[model samples]
Target: MNLLDIEHLRVDLRSRERRGAPRTVIHDVSLTIAPGEAVGVVGESGSGKSMTVKAVMRLLPRRATVGGTLEFRGTSIPAMPGRDLARFRSQLVSMIYQDPRAHINPLRTIGDFLIEGVVASGQMNRAEALEAACTLLRDVGVNDPQRRLSQYPHQLSGGLLQRMMIVMALLPSPELVLADEPTTALDVTVQSEVMAILTEQIRERSVGLLFITHDLDLAAAVTDSLAVMHAGTVVERGPSADIYAAPRHPYTAALLASRPSPTSVARPVSIPGRPVSAFEAGEGCAFASRCPYAIGQCRTERPEPRTAGTRTVACHRSDELEAVLAEGVRA
Candidate 1:
């Protein structure tokens, strides 16, 4: 069975403006992750990538109304009772936030944060959890594990803190890990190292991973498959190498063209306009205004997802766009 399965997931949050109606942030988004698979969700900021995963983790704000089926290991998430849900959150699934400092309590020692979940879940006693924490800390490359655990979050570097977060996520041996841009705040060198550790750990343990990031290159480098989201919906999805080499959607192609390449001397082309939120797009394709290949039909009609071999794309002009991308690759 797939480790995680989401279908037609829609989330609407109460607008911050008191007078406005609820605004939809996630629109009918759906994806699945198999056991031991690593799937990357990529998009520009505010494109609902984070919201999608937040929904999966059931961490959205109280004001947000969520609708859809979210299942993990053949069990429904939204319908899980309070105690079952608590166990689900603490043991079956884990989340690695983008900012470790924000998630970790500054006043608490690292040992407190690391062992809390295991102890709370009643999987291990305090002393046993501490011993396991030390082992995990060592596994993630921390030296003097006992000493480091005694130190507070403020004392550790960003990379080390992130590694610690990974250790916490793995402590319970979760079937799935939801990593929401866990390395974004770190420097490039640190980012690569952290990602390497995460990928290696997940692979060795046979855990599924849902990695959300705005950085397409990083997503491509680490994940087996990629889902490109836009305006609260997935615009394209496929194997990472296939999507990177030949993007089917105009937005996906634009994103690829915007990335700086070491070998390409030509100036990188930026997307013509800013992204539009889901509420801003009524009936038309959300990217119609910004899409270079958009036609009259694209301006008025929202396209449905269509599968072609190993990929899926929601674009009326995917056929033409595929040809264009193919030609560019040939050149």
Candidate 2:
């Protein structure tokens, strides 16, 4: 059985204005992660990557509602009761947010912040949790784990704090992790180190991961499969290598073309037009206005997701676009 399954998932947030309609943030998305597998969700900002993960974590606002199937180990996440949901969150799954400093309490020491959850969840006693934390700290290359624990969040560097957040997420021995751009704030060198530690920990522990980021190359490198999202929908999904080599969707190809290539002498080509939200998408494909290959049919008819060999693509012109998209990536 898949560790996590999301099919045709939709998210809507009720507007605050009086008598205002709810806005659809996620139109449709489908993904699955097997045990010890890493699946990357990559897209530009406002593409619903973070929102999708927020739904999985059950961290959406009170006004938010979900549709379609979202399951973990065959159990429905949306239907889980309050107590069961709490247990599921505390024991079965963990999340590493993008910013550690923002998540950690300013007044609390690192020890208080880290051990509180595990102790409250009964995963470990105080002594055992402390010991485990120190061990993880050392594993992440932190010097003098005991002293670090007593120090506050402000005292630590961005890289070290992120590593500590990773330690906290793993303390519960979760079956799956939702990592939302965990290295976005760090320097390039520190980002590499943090990712290495995170990847190593997940692999050694046999944990599943749903990694969310905008870095296409970084995501493809760390993940087995990649899902390219656009305007709150998954435009393309397949094996990382396959998608990188031959993107069927124009949006995917555009994203690949827009990346800054270190080896290539040519400057990165920017995709024309700005990205839109789910609500902004009209009658047809959200990307029609920006797609270079779009036609009148594409502007009038919404494309549904269909299988194309090893990939699932939501594009009206995927068949003919295959060669052009591949060439774009090669260029």
Candidate 3:
């Protein structure tokens, strides 16, 4: 059964009064998480990847604003009021932000931080919260749960601190956890270790996971499904392995080519242009200017998602990209 569901979700960060008008950061996106499914939302910066997840968490900044339907466990979220939303936040969904340093209180002890996070969950009191904290610390692979909890955030290594934030989010045992770039700061080995800890911990529980990251390879390593965003729209999504092996959109194709991967035994081919800003637009497809095989139709008109072979691709000329994807299948 699906634990979290989102549909036709749209988020616009651009202000018409400013200059660029009606730039939808997250445009008409829909996603769902089954009871224990781990899904990855992958794309480069300004791809509207994080914003879609943030909208579900109700964590979007005031200035950005959110629109479209948001549902969790079959209920519409926008209809959920303030107090109920607050209550839902503690029990239903929890998010581990991209940066641990920003999330942690520099003044507070690590022990205090974890305790407060659990207490806020509304399911645990002081004593139980403390017990959960120690277990959580140990579960995150913290070597000295007791002695270390007393130390401040600065005292812990960057990896430990990042894992601590993960512990805080996981402690509640909420129905869903949205971890945004949880291992970005860690070294490769540490990244793998943290991923293992997260996988092991989150697996035992039936918690639905929305593991958000810009790393295609990292997402592939963990997620059951993948969503690739480009220029504020979800250009492609499917089974994680299938999306990597047969990315249907040009933008996803570029992302796969540019990323570091074992398949790329040769040097990685850099996708030529930088990612377009959320505030960017043109007369046609957002990526038309830079697409290698752009034809007049692509340049003149944008395309909607075309369904084929257990995948979704948003492009006017998906057949051409399909040929490229076909090569990946043979490899």
Best by lDDT: 2
Predicted candidate 2, C-alpha RMSD: 0.9
Q: lDDT, candidate 3, residue 280? A: 72
Residues 70-161, model 2: lDDT tens digits = 99999999999999898899989999989998999989999888888899988899999999999988988889999999999999999999
Per-residue accuracy of model 3 over 237-262 as CA lDDT, tens digit each: 78999877777787877777776666
Model 3, position 58: C-alpha lDDT score:
78
Enumerate residue pairs that collide in model 1.
Answer: none
**Which pairs clash inside model 2?**
none
Q: State candidate 1's TM-score.
A: 0.97
Model 3 scores a TM of 0.92
> Candidate 1: lDDT over CA atoms?
0.90
Candidate 2 regions exceeding 4 Å error are none
On TM-score, who's better, 2 or 3?
2
